[model samples]
Target: MNLIEHLKEDVRFEESLKACMNCGVCTAICPAAEFYDYDPRRICDLVQRGDEEEIEQVLRSDTIWYCGQCMSCKTRCPRGNVPGELISVLRKVSQELGLFRHSEKGRQQVLLMNSVHRNIMEIGYCVYPDRVDPDYHPEQGPIWRWYHEHIADIAPKLGANYHGAGPGALRDISEEDLQEVRKIFEVTGGTEFSEKVKKNS
Candidate 1:
């Protein structure tokens, strides 16, 4: 599809891309630009020019995935543009077109989808203590390991209901609520798209 056609598919993209005056403000304020070779200003420039080939290249490259989606660019842009939101639109387009598989970082979506998606679907929490294995996530630290081991003993002290019903952290999620979440996934096409991503990866 043409760049303009694609842009029209999502109104947010058109709204996100205000005329780039070649101002370096977006790149200057971009945290990803500092740490990585990612420059949202360059992306804006390319897309603003309606260069389909370059935009496709941007979609396939690691540059598009580097945005932290902090929307700091939105806050800093002189034209009221949102490079972070634009990056999000780019990411969705990349994933939908199966272009994300071209980058190593993008390929990691399989791992993220498997873990985070399943965590939300089954436990109703994206990052539950029981699911965080110390071997897999050493960054969680020794304290997390200790807490995981002594959760039963420590949870009561912290006023967390642990496995019981009702409010507070790690509380049991009802089957009814879980079914509702599943319904949302189904209605939003999230489940089908996620399955397609897994298969393509």
Candidate 2:
């Protein structure tokens, strides 16, 4: 299928893009636009035009990855278009087509696969405390270092299970439950998607 056809295959494409009057409301409210050279309004316009070459350029660019998926654009859109949701469709298509490797931000999917995806598949937590080593995450700074060092003590105080069993924050997920999680991913094509991201990266 072509880029537009691939995009249309995603349910979010039709749901997110009803109409775009180019009012730029989505861009105005987008947090990513302030931090990056991203414009949700422009993305909507580009996808709405159904220009295959333009859409392919978008799929290969960093613009799609710039969306944080906070869904803030959904709140204020006069036409009820959800640019954040549209970005999700674009990113998925990019990854499936292996075009994500063409951009710097898109290539970060490998790191995410290693960290978040690995954590989920193994421990059933996307951001497991143990995997969040401060050495790799320097931006976490001294406080995170202190927390990392004293998580055993701090976690208990904060009512987190912290790798322990039973129901609580940061608790250890049972093997049975982890298997269930894996099954969900497998059935949902998440495992296939992860493999695609790895292969593309």
Candidate 3:
């Protein structure tokens, strides 16, 4: 069982596979699988068979970004395998590969990641990055004030607190880690600032 290097959490892919029932249900229910012809069943089967390349190919696919973390497939799986969780772990790995920032879907994930990083920098908890409605209203009294007040209402639905006025995000990350992330982002051209620049230019 070789360990895969990851950028964020240390996800043990092997541990998530103990309950693989080979029922083919995960492949059936995955939205990405349906839309992109991605087969989680095949990926899992190949990984179990010691075929790392096949699993790697699956990891490289853009199809992985569709998982919404609903856990619907996980609850219904007869094999006890949480394909959704596995997809999440794969998404983390995919982000490491810098594939996450390429498409619009991927960019959305990057925004979420940036939000969490900002939380780590400012407040310790990862708050949802306050999204603005289509109609820009100055009467809303600044974005922060609106987010601070109304964020609590959505907490119950999200299943997270995400509202505590904790310390703001860190202004500076460790130089070494920051450099590494930047280098990786630069290589993939995935940084939001980079994308914005590219589009404007």
Candidate 4:
């Protein structure tokens, strides 16, 4: 299938790309462009021109993955284009095509999908503080490490339910609700995508 046609079917991508005048505003406002070899303007041009080879090249490269998805370009585009949304479309296409394995950072989606999705399915929280290993997530800082080590003791003091039933932070999630979450994941292909990412990565 033609890549542009496949991408155009996505509502986000369809709405995001109105036109590109090559004004360079999106690239100028992109934070990723400042730090990495990423340019939203370039992506816009490639997609606008329907350069399938270049678009596929971008999907397999670090360029598409460099987008922080902060939606800065969406807010700043002179033509009302959404470069961030366009990048997301590229990413999803790349993942579906197994092209994400071409980049170092892209390969880490395996770990991210495994950790975050597993947490969501099993615990009903996308991020459970206790499950975060300090060794792996050093950027979480020493304070988070201390919190992880002492959550049981500190949670009750902070008015958190901890493992107790019902609502509020760290409370026990019901099995029924957890099953519902798993069903949602199954229906939405979240589980399949996670497994695919893991296998490909």
Top-TM-score structure, candidate number: 2
- Please identify model 3 stretches exceeding 4 Å from their true place: 1-12, 19-21, 29-38, 97-108, 123-201
C-alpha root-mean-square deviation, candidate 3: 9.2
When 1 and 3 are scored with lDDT, the better candidate is 1
Model 2 misplaced regions, further than 4 Å: none
lDDT for each of the candidates? 0.86, 0.92, 0.57, 0.86
- Ranking of models by lDDT: 2, 4, 1, 3
Q: Model 3: per-residue lDDT, tens digit, 57-141?
A: 5555666666666666776678777766777777666555555555455556646555555453343335434533324335656
TM-score of each: 0.94, 0.94, 0.51, 0.93
Give per-residue CA lDDT, model 1, range 119-166, as digits (tens).
888878888878889888899899988999999899999999998898
User: In candidate 1, how many Å is residue 146 off?
Assistant: 0.5
In the predicted model 2, the residue pairs found to clash are none
Which tens-of-lDDT digit does each residue in 90-193 have in candidate 2?
99999999999999999999999998899899888788767879999899999999999999989989988888889989888899999999999999999999
In lDDT terms, how accurate is model 2? 0.92
**What's model 1's TM-score?**
0.94
Q: Which residue pairs in candidate 4 collide? A: none
Give each model's clash number.
Answer: 0, 0, 9, 0
Error of 3 at 92 (Å): 2.1
